[model samples]
Target: MRKHWTIVTGLLVIGSVWLTACSDGKSGQSSVDSDKPAEQAKSYANEPAELVIYGAPGDPPEVWNERFGDQLQKKFPNYKFTYIQRSGTNTIENMIASGAQVDLIYDSVGNAVNSVVATGSQLDLSELVKKHNVDMSRFEPATVEAVKQFGGLYGFPVHSGGLVLYYNKAIFDKFGVGYPKDGMTWDEAIELGNKLTRNDNGTQYIGLGQSYIHVLSMNAYSLPFVDKATEKAAINSDKYKKIVDTLIMAPAKAIGYKEQIATLKRLFNNNDFMKERNIAMYVMNFGLQGQKDFESLDWDMAALPVFKDNPGMGTQPYPNFLFISNASKYKDQAMEVLKYVTSDETQLALSKKGYIPVLKNESIKNAFAQDSNVKNKNVVKAVFTNKFASPIARTKYDGKLNSPLQTNLIKAILGEIDLNTALRQTEEEVNKAIEAEKKK
Candidate 1:
């Protein structure tokens, strides 16, 4: 019989039903000694290797070189570092399909899906984490949970972005309405939206508008995409219906809200809130390097609206995670790089460049608050109020499921079909697709 090791409180020990691994006790002595894996393993810090970074599109090597590449090279003087700019949603998947020599992958959790985990390409870093004595507690609870869903400890977060309400103070002043304050509920936001959503001199001013993607991603109620036990699509449940009703329908009911939202999307589909200046309140994540866009406009952010029932819960977290490819021979070196990038020193350095560092260091948080160019904005509210929902455990066939669901949602919203009928049809269509996928 093979012995299994369990990861308890960030230490590896022989136990039942833990992170599945087949390391003989020949290498382990005790849980206390497990933290020395880095010292026990051969050091590759001086070995010649190129650490490939797969990040967002249009992100030049210079930006990453400045952020952490140079620091990584300084730590491992002999190792070379390079960046592979990601172009589309399937960039990493395409790399995997083509057998690219990928060392490390870093992307938003939204972009980096369960396929990486399901394909057995991402490294299981539980042991590396224990070896490095990385402080798991330093990361936010929600952030840590998000990484664990794909595979236990397969990666770590470098920075996080979450939903917040960006309100134009100038618009509020013009409408004689009080500016939105932190801790406001969705109901309160809608009430305020009613006041500000009107036409002034035929120049339409929409009160509240948030993108569908953001609203769905930041659902206050934690609804799973598929039921765990039956592996069935779970979008037609009462919980999911409430989520749609509150997040989608209620907001659309605001006066001329639909037309105004379409107009905003057409005006600047690039996610520039302040540039338009027509929308009073816009909801979105604190995107990487978007701080400068708000410089010219007099605007501030408020915490994302909470559920009246679930008062403290904000929304699911959005964090960018770093993973090592299982196929890479330099995985040990890649693990070393992963440890360094998510370290306190490295996270603090990146935070200065306008990232929400995953580490829960008081000074980093303070620095973020102090460095805010947008005055009177309670920037930290989103972090404190967040309660992350588990990422949906998806099948490879989900690509088929999302399309019909989204199409029907639009139809329901446009009065082509009722919400109940739409949900029922979506459920049937998705379950059929899941069944077909299982057959394959």
Candidate 2:
């Protein structure tokens, strides 16, 4: 019989399960340190002759391999890689229990904690990093710091999802509104949104739109949802107040007291800007360019809006990390693999395909969207027009904090509650959620 090691904290599992994975659905796998069959025993990471790698969602071998598998095979044909995907009961936990390889984990920060940290299979790569002379300075500083945000240096960030401002050219031309430039502040953006939000011939055109659910998470200010040090809610501060207030006003100049919440919901959707043909401007993830809905619009993109204090800043970096598990005995080989994963060659190929590279090199950043379906070179350049904000270290309660803040913000917008009351109520609710998680 095999013995299983349960995760230390249910809080990490709870938080991770609530948050979505980087590409696929959430996976709650366990770890193994038990005896197994002879053939299965041969699959450990120390047995470098055979190895396993978990890939991102897509195709049979995780779509990540579709592009780079051949390259890896050409260099090392004997390296057997089991690209473990989320298939029913065929989870990493089961594999480890069955004596299969446990090595590199390619996932986002949120899932990284849930998948490995929660299961206690994590292996810190700090010593290996120094041994291999990996240049931490080459990547964006935020991405490097973010890998260590949870505690130890678990992995390197290889890719990110970026934010950019999208606008409908035809809508601007019709409204006689000047097209938005790259560096408008949130206030200036609202003024532009105000011009476009009108019921022209009953069409009820919205001047501006945004991904409201994303605004708080990808905050340009790098504000945190909860403070890890105190394990308490950290959202009652002035910065949070400013963020909520800005979100309330960004879509409409003055939303009618009765229609405020419904109006925000309608405008916050991506479809409202793309398929519905109502929104003139929108703030969204840059990857939406590949959506089929984009083919119908006369649209282009601009840099994400900046705060007046910070002249030209982009949204915080939301990167996917390449984690190495402690279960692996071959740290040196794993370090080399991580090196190849972040090399300029791998970064360039993925960048052309619109996977935002983590490297800080201007040439690599500039190459973004060059090979995508996007035909406009100028539009591609706008993605890097501003400097990216550092990532906010995430906490287990980020998802819990999102709702209370949005609810109170809407109440404040409708005059049902003032800013002080809204934030006060939000903090109370956040603390309650935290207490409940602790009890579990």
Candidate 3:
């Protein structure tokens, strides 16, 4: 009778290696003969197998296949590669609770850690990466660092989407201001915003509806939410304070107090750049590929504005990682699949189709969005000219820290409270939450 892979309990890491073992009912050890070394085993690839790859919180099954499914299927024809879609009912927690085996989980680095890694079932791939001779240097350094910020090689990126300023040419033309240029500083961007913001014929054009949250979250300062050693809220420092004052509050305040709240709310809405066309300059990431109306508009791209103090730097990298799970018996097979996903051939193909390649290849950047829906604009200049700001440590408390920081920051932005009060309240709330998180 044929044997199947079963989930292993107590897969512990001893010393420098992951000392894990799973069985196929017939054997007390792994599927391979116990007499042979585990590394010497074929990783169960000799037989017909199924690998369950889970994607979550966003993206449908079809989208998954288009980006990864088809390519992975072609690369590994021996195994049946499955994509498990996370739905309202079928969550990561529920999937784990129900005793389903997920071989790999891929999503935005932030959400993936919060949903999947927080389950304590995530595999640190340091040993496996070394054993396979996977080159970590191929990826943008900061993205690799973001994964290690949790203190292990938890995962590696498949693709990236850093900040870029998308400006409406019509808005700039009407105002007769020269469009914002590449390498513009935060101070320069504010001055540009001041010129374009107006109530021309009662249209209420606000110049810098630049996705305020993205600007804050992906700030060039590389500020953390909580200090790892102190476990205290890290947002109260001068670095973070300057970020809020310069990026978050500046744009809304420029539009004037009467429309500040409404203008601030519009920051995340892309329609301000496309449909209403009232926003002059909106900074967004690669998610812009999904915008259908952008191609029809008179638009262009510029580098994300940098702070004068940190000139030639852009927002931190936001790369989506393909993570291997600890419970998987098909660890070798999963790593093989990841290798294919990040390979030069694969990354270049995806980059041409407007999915930003995670590999640090200039050729890939130059060819980016060549066949994409928004191919006409200068995408390389928009994204590739500046080095990504070094990213901060993404603690386990990152998801929890968002509420206090944003809520207090919003209140402060609207002048309901001062910036000092906002910072203090956030620190207290986050510190209290960190203590609570420790108990769990």
| Best candidate (score: lDDT) | 3
Q: Judged by TM-score relative to the true structure, which candidate is superior, 1 or 3? A: 3
Clashing pairs in 3: none
lDDT of 3 at 345: 77
* lDDT score of residue 399 within candidate 3: 63
Q: TM-score order of candidates, best first?
A: 3, 2, 1
Report the lDDT tens digits of candidate 3 across residue range 1-440. Answer: 22222222221211122222211111111222246544533243334556776676457767777887776555555666555666656666766766677777777866766766678667888777665556677788888887777667777788888889888899899979998889898888888988888988878887776665577768888887777668778888777888888877777677553274545542345766778788788887747747778657888888888888888889899888877888888776677667767777788888998887887778987899898877887787888878988877766676666778777777887778988889889889988988998998
List model 1 lDDT by residue over 304-422, tens digit each: 88888888678677888877766666666676776677666777667665577877677876556444443246676644545555555434444554667766766666667888888
Candidate 2 C-alpha lDDT tens digits along 236-292: 888887886786554544443226345654325787777888778888877777678
lDDT of each: 0.64, 0.66, 0.71
| Pairs that clash in candidate 2 | 123-326
Regions of candidate 1 where Cα sits further than 4 Å from its true position = 1-44, 56-58, 88-90, 227-232, 259-275, 288-295, 369-376, 385-407, 414-416, 429-440
Residue 65 accuracy (lDDT) in model 1: 66
Ranking, lDDT, top scorer first: 3, 2, 1
lDDT of 2 at 283: 81
- The true-versus-predicted C-alpha distance at residue 417 of model 1, in Å, is 3.6
